[model samples]
Target: MRKGFLLAVALVAFLFPSGAGAAEKVWSNSVPDSVWSDGANWVPAGVPASVDHVVIGRSKTIVGITNAAFAGGLLLSPDVSLDIRAGHNLTLGSGDAAVNIELEGNAEIRTVGASALAFDAVNRLNLNVPSSARLKLGKMSAPAAVHQSGGIVQLTGTVTAAAGGTDWHVNGGLLYVKKNDAFSGNMTVKVAAGKEVQFEKGADAGASFDFSAGSSITSLDVADATSAVPALKLKALTGDVILKLINVPATLAPGDVLRVIDCDSPIPAAAQVRLDPASAAKYEIQLSGDRRSVMIGTRAVASADVVVFTPPTDTLASREYEPGVPFAASFDVTSSAGQALTVTTIPGSSLPVWLGYVVTPKGGASSDVTVTLSGTPDATVSGDIPLGFRASTATASADMTYTIVKKGSGGAPGPNPNPRPGQPGPLPRPNPGDPLLPDPNRKSRSGGGGCDAGLAGIVALLALLPLRSRRRK
Candidate 1:
């Protein structure tokens, strides 16, 4: 029985030797020319007839692999642009074999295989596929650097993704989302050293994106539902940094630390933090205070300083010079500081007589005149100024004194030149010609003694009578 089995195996090997050898040579020399023109699709230039099964040679472009998949596996060479349009699906067969399409220049590929589409040097690779295509990257010998400059990984169909289990790097490039389409899935989306990935409009807002110092993402605006109206989410990966907040609102969650060094005055009143649900693992909400020591989870931090602004109080009060007062207007001033206060007037307008004084005006007159307070007197400022008027008409001479009194106390500023509830008029000015105006003293008449005719004639007759009496005697 052993001899019979050995004979059968020998016969089988003899019959299938050529068939078995054909499959092995399929990958050998699979590389094409430097450039593959549209001759007939993957059918290399010169394939020997005696070889029977053609092998993929080095530095060759494998054009149409539709039939090549049925025949055997296809091998792609490096520094070669593999241009595959839509509806071209290339598959990798069993035994853990690998196929690679090198995109040296501009190239489009619809890949569905265990193998990967590698960009050896700086190159643009466009992967256009139908419904979400999944390709797994086993391991990277070196870093898989994809330089997609002016090349687009377009998804003409519905939701699609390109996920990498291993490290997949994108050096200086863009992940452009075409209009009316969406790209989703968990992707590291690494930005290589000194490279960036800018996400423009129509790009997914919630893309699990991070950035390097030399790299950045652009046109990334937040959803309208968030408290941060049209804000940005910067995935912090480095040490202490100050993220500038422009026209965007900022909200802090519990366990989130933020530092504000120097800020301009008059901070917006609407500045506050709101809890974010998407990142709930951190905390609910965190609000900063004024210079107070607080904690955002384990982060020991302090709040920003609050500034209070005050306006000028000079317009409400004023002062002027009076004759009797020293060099200052006799005005009253008090202090709520519970200490003696000093009032100073505008420089150059300082009084020459009194250094400082409080003058209270009272009367039924226009109250629009500017009233000022000046003085160093340290009591509850309340007092009056005496108004004395002397009349010197063509006939009479008389002096009138009127008390200019203040009704309220405690320096309650009020009616000057006008009479208060208890005070008289702001000492009335003496009238000369008006007879209806009464004189405070009854002894002094209105006119002077110059027009006393009767008294003068009586004096002359009395003088003559005295003379006649003297002669007769």
Candidate 2:
């Protein structure tokens, strides 16, 4: 019958043999004391168990594996290298599928017993754990992570979340214990550049530290601001926030009080405030105790820095409005130079023909310009009614001399009870407040030394990361 069907097809191709082209153990030449299961140091003649698929070279790279090494996939491609020495340990997943690992060089990953060191690697992985290694994170999906830069990473067992995102990049190292240590989801910490990662707070988990500005947001949770909660809460997001009142200590005898910024403490006897050496140097900022806290100095009998436009009254009191009742004064169209500043009003033909000049562009985020000297006295008469105002920009300019007085005999309406303390003029040219008179247009700011001192270390690295408050800024 056709020679017995060609001797039964050559005895079924000489007794079965079809694993679909499996073996690919590459680790040729340059034998630097090899022993990764030894077979003349693995090329294709044996020693690579559990369905092998490995490749180690950029010159064979110190291969040694006393035991525990099973692979179905692994490739340290370009300029390669690997070292799973120190008592051997390396386990990659396969059961639930997806197991790929295709790294590029300098890997010194070590391990031990009781089952650890589990990283699936299906796609992108950057786990550079140095300081000799202790990595244990598996149960894969894809986006794998663990960039420790100087070893020891044991983020709990069973390992959850690692499908779309799984981050923990300290960049330098030392993410050891110190406290609770349990972490669940919310993981996104990338504090690099001279790295630092201090952890604590487990049980249920909570942490927040995002040093904005192109932020990858470092996560922290060291806890202890009287921990019932806070261990770390480092998240500094300040583009600008100023209430500066430095070294303002120089007031002796007008009730000698130089409080920096007191938004509103006790005091409410109709709102008391006693500090006005003629509104010092024409005034620049003053809510006058009624609103409390805005006493910046250099005007105790001065003539220039003028702009503390008043009416924060309770004393020196004499505010009697009858003809249309609402004449006001309180100015601070502010500027540490963040924006809006350009005001001009000049009406002094002996002003008040029963006048009207209501430039009300009020304050907040530094916007204070309140001048509403209502009109109605069409005839009730008055005297010295001068009006002038200016508030420039290009660089800066400020001038004001608004005076209005008209009384049909009553008792209140005061200010200017014989106050003449003048002496301050030259300050329009190149603006020199002077430290040797420097101001050749001087404008260099943000220099405490580079990156504005690294953004003041983001509040000293959010008070040196230990975390609390979660939403932080």
Candidate 3:
């Protein structure tokens, strides 16, 4: 029985062979041409099928994909290169399993024309472009998790999002988006120390990173390097760009300048550049004369103190005042740096003709001062009247608004002269006898005197008269 079992196992092994399962195919370059479809160019003497793992190891030769191809995974060894030729496609992975494409040691993969690389699996496409690798592709579609550490990836076409996941971690690399191509995923650019990532226009005059597709970067860290050129250069901006300064030297003295961004075209009015609040506190940030570059003056000292104005709690015109009555309200004003402040009403925000304000001191030059708003609102001014006050020093100023709401006659709130569209107007005071309105003098039917009461009276009268007619019938 043991000999029979051994003979059967041997027969099965001989028929099936170990090579029947998935195998790895290495690029041998045995043929004179570099076509990937040529079986003679790969080891094992056959083209790689969907169940094969392909590798290009330590070859300077550029392997070309002239036709549609499939592979379970692909790896490029140091200095090896590959290209998907024009109009060709390369599909990676099979079934519902995850696959990987690793480019390391300066390996490169460039796609020409409309050629594309796609991943065909439910699981993620793990792409690692590290160690100075370069990947320039027209487009890539997959549920991808891309990690780049010290490499460059220039994407000229869109990277469509998938259900599995699509994210990018650019730890120390440049991920350039060309020609308004959109990346439909979140990208975090946390460049390593001593490194910088730049966003610059491509060959197209209108090229820009298209963040309008709901894609956004967490933040950009700008080092205080003295590069004459701006770290971020573009012709125009389409979305908000947030920046935080990093590696600021402790020895940086006040007034030292740092250049950050440059725009060849005028920045869109809707676009904004948000700077870190902490960085803004320590630097005087402004754009150049032509609005081409952004400069930061380190630790700029304020020339003069700023005045702080504190309005009353009822600053929003919530409280109603009686017309033609003496109204008085007071607010305090102080200086931020304890310097003397001057208080005055803003030029165009003068109080209404019947209202006036008086500062505590005649000259209005004091560190801590009070402004009193005292006036009898004119009977004709039976609505909200806004008053403005400004506290200022030599270099800085602050303004506050005080609104006075005057009630109309009979203690009713005054009507808005210019009510906005869709705003409900005052309720109509219906006449006492209006048919559409309920009569205040009328009694409820349940309490009698309505239709119910009249019906009951008729029924009572019929009962008292006895049902003689009905009985006769």
Candidate 4:
């Protein structure tokens, strides 16, 4: 029985043959010009069908080694792609390796050592990244260059030319053309030092050019601004940008309030003084320069706006005597240092004893105008407003309150009219018949009750005298 078992085992071993360990399995009927013993295939000339991954020689195979040099090229059809792993080195001509690897649907080529890799018209080329496998070009004599027209190309590692020369050369690297001959979206071209980039006149119309932020170009020669159909709504002129005024109302005029809020950062101050060239009012009142500091004499000083009242047309004719109700004058508070200034107003007084104004920048940002009134008075009295204040926009009514005064043995009351006195102050007088006399609610203490009490008391004393006489009779 033992002899029979031994004979059967020998027969089985012979039939199977250990030669399977030495043989290589070929798939998809794909054959290589030369294959290594350790199952590596080499296509020096080129491959007929596209390949996914090609392994190079291992420890065993000295397969694809060739002493006679020749030009090798690999052309992958549009539907196929190529992937070359690490440790693969393909040597070309006795002079330099002239290997061309072309992949169709977005190919990747990576090389570990001093080698060169080239691409042709691939959608995207990822070089030296493991995730996106690429063809390796081991140490050679020429520089590695890539040219692409359509998709994105990223360089994971430093790339040098195989052919060492300062002169211009286009190694068989990336040469891509747009699949549809149309302009790409948001195209930005960046060129670095020791790098040369060129652009041919685009087939379509001219496009907008932006000299990146904080970046300066030595010279930009545009054919013509009018001819180039630039899509940019604004263009920078002499480092300052000029924008087209959009949605400007026809009614906007010089001295009229035009407030723009919530604008882009670093917005330039708007020219306050704008003239209408075509109108009869050709020369506009220029309130430009600085709002914060006005040059007084030779010195720069912060001053508040002083406007003399322009008498109302309706009251100018009817109102009585003297320089007739002077226009209330007030000021917008501003400081010498382009900062918003604030002034406190007397309670109940429209005229701000202390006022605030946006310090117009010497060359900074724009400021807004806000009005606040304070102080106690018999009536609400407003002061002269600055140039930016349009009366139509003011909350004050057409009528104004003037301080009222009575002789009362005193020639004038309370320092007589301030601002400009002897204009016969318009202080309110107490009437004997008025039931609301000596209004306690009045803001001014003078008008509140003192005057009304004095007049009412005198009349009561006379009435009491008659009553006392009748009682005595």
Query: Each prediction's TM-score against the native?
Result: 0.29, 0.27, 0.41, 0.26
Q: Which candidate number maximizes TM-score?
A: 3
For all candidates, what are the clash counts?
41, 22, 0, 39
Query: In candidate 4, how many Å is residue 220 off?
Result: 19
Worst ten in a row by lDDT for model 4: 292-301
Q: Using lDDT as the measure, what is the rank order of every candidate, best first? A: 3, 2, 1, 4
Candidate 4 lDDT, 346-381, residue by residue in tens: 344543333232322223462323332222322333
RMSD of 2: 30.0
Q: Candidate 2 on 7-39: residue-level lDDT in tens?
A: 533442243221345455666646555666766
| CA deviation > 4 Å runs, candidate 3 | 1-20, 30-33, 147-150, 163-165, 171-174, 184-198, 202-473
Indicate the residue-level lDDT of 386 in model 4.
20
Q: Kindly list the per-residue Cα lDDT of model 3 for residues 274-344, writing each as its tens digit.
A: 55666666666667776667666675456657566655453323345677678777777777676767888
Best by lDDT: 3
Residue 318 of model 4, lDDT score: 22
Give me the displacement of residue 251 in model 3, in angstroms.
Answer: 28
lDDT of 1 by residue, 64-183 (tens): 333222222222223333333233332322222222222323323333332232222212222222122222222112112233332334432322233332222444344443323232
Cα RMSD (angstroms) for every candidate in the order listed? 22.2, 30.0, 24.0, 21.8
